[model samples]
Target: MNSSRRLVVAVAMSAAFALCLPFTANAGHDDNGTDPDNRSQAVKGFNLTANGTKAMNHGKSQLERSVITTSWGGGDIEVYDKDYGDNGWHGYADCTDWNALWTSCDIIRVRFNQYSYKTSSQWKSLGCHEFGHTADLGHRARSNDTDNNSCMREEIWPLYYDQHDLNAIKAGT
Candidate 1:
């Protein structure tokens, strides 16, 4: 091809490549950031029901296996199972305290609603969802997930993080 043709082809290929690249922006809400120290998070449970305990354990395990580092001890993140009847929420996560720079969360709180009447698998899904939030992840819609397979969805489904979630976490923390 002529030099002019080659240049045009190269520019087109670069644009296409850039368009195909996955979104690398952090998926989590900007209000909370990863743990300030070493980007590792420590999770603990409090006054949890039997189901709640199981859920919390599942969440911790999943987080540990993901790109976001997590441990079973320490109180960097606190999980609680409560009976919030018909409040229209299965679970939620919040940053109770912020680091000195206000960029990361010093303490995060995760809560599960027992009134949701979820099955064991559903509880596990909830665990994964809430834990994602504590990691600064926002809710993902089913339409947004190409495979429709992510616990980060607003509803309780899937038991683990998807590649998109991992990529977002990696980019964020």
Candidate 2:
């Protein structure tokens, strides 16, 4: 059983790797067209290229474990880096305005900003955090009495989320 599971994981990983191909040269950006930082509504889908693809490949298992492949409107999130030619985990995720990538692919890539301020520790958790978003898991509560520190928002410093955020992710907010 363990062997079969490993085989399955390996195959899945391979397929995921295959998917990463054919998009590195052209995976685009808004190019200062519109800043997603202003939108509260779910951002659209896009592609993850080269290093972004590699980062997702590195963390794809975690994302798959968190239900990365689901038929929902959660949207696509392209993972990427400013310098795909370089070798490093940019450590970020963002959704571009990509509705044509795929209808179900609302959040296409789980991006990584190569020059981000995030460290390894933060990137590790960021991968999970974006996975949560892909799974429709938003931030969780950060109070003293809830399931704190186990989710994206809680993990974010400066207390990005409160009880409502927790309730949202848990309750699909």
Candidate 3:
């Protein structure tokens, strides 16, 4: 395989190992920053409903509402929003985390940054993106300084959603 592809595999492996499949999840609720919610947080996954899956099959769209009851360390997820805590956390207006909750039997949650119903492909891709983090996958290291426009990275994450992204999720992280 080419060096870049090898790097891809290496990155995936590194993230998986970093977790050690431990437990411990964090809470959050910065409103936009880090406002401290003092509630609870968990991520839920449901097999796409018949309609949802049908939409995907027909090139339509679908997205389930995910609530993030933030309360504490903002938990492990990085809460990002110019209006709340840091102006540019997590590279956008979303708090995302690569939490290893298996050992502790906890769960990490991610609050979708925006509300939009794009094509099913897009929504599915977004699921792939967030789920990737749930599985411990992170953006690929940058070619230049630490700023790659790659999908794993934030800059071009909205551009294209490829199979490698799916693979990363499958392989864990």
Against the correct fold, how does model 3 do in TM-score?
A: 0.33
What is the full ranking by TM-score, best candidate first?
A: 1, 2, 3
Note the residue pairs that clash in candidate 1: none
Leading candidate by TM-score: 1
In terms of lDDT, model 3 sits at: 0.35
Q: What would the per-residue lDDT of candidate 3 be over residues 40-109, giving only the tens digit for each residue?
A: 3323323444433332222111111112232234243332212223334332223333225322213344
Of 1 and 2, the candidate ranking higher by lDDT: 1
TM-score of 2: 0.39
Candidate 3: regions farther than 4 A off: 1-86, 90-105, 112-128, 144-150
Model 2 lDDT tens row, 18-72 = 9987542211111122122211233222364444443444344443343123322
Better of 1 and 3 by lDDT: 1
Task: Give the CA lDDT, 0 to 100, for residue 121 in model 2.
Answer: 55
N/CA/C clash count, model 3: 16
Q: Candidate 1 residues 41-83, lDDT tens each?
A: 8888988999999889888887776676887786688888888
Question: Number of clashes in every candidate structure?
Answer: 0, 19, 16
Candidate 3, run of 10 with poorest lDDT = 58-67
lDDT of each: 0.78, 0.43, 0.35
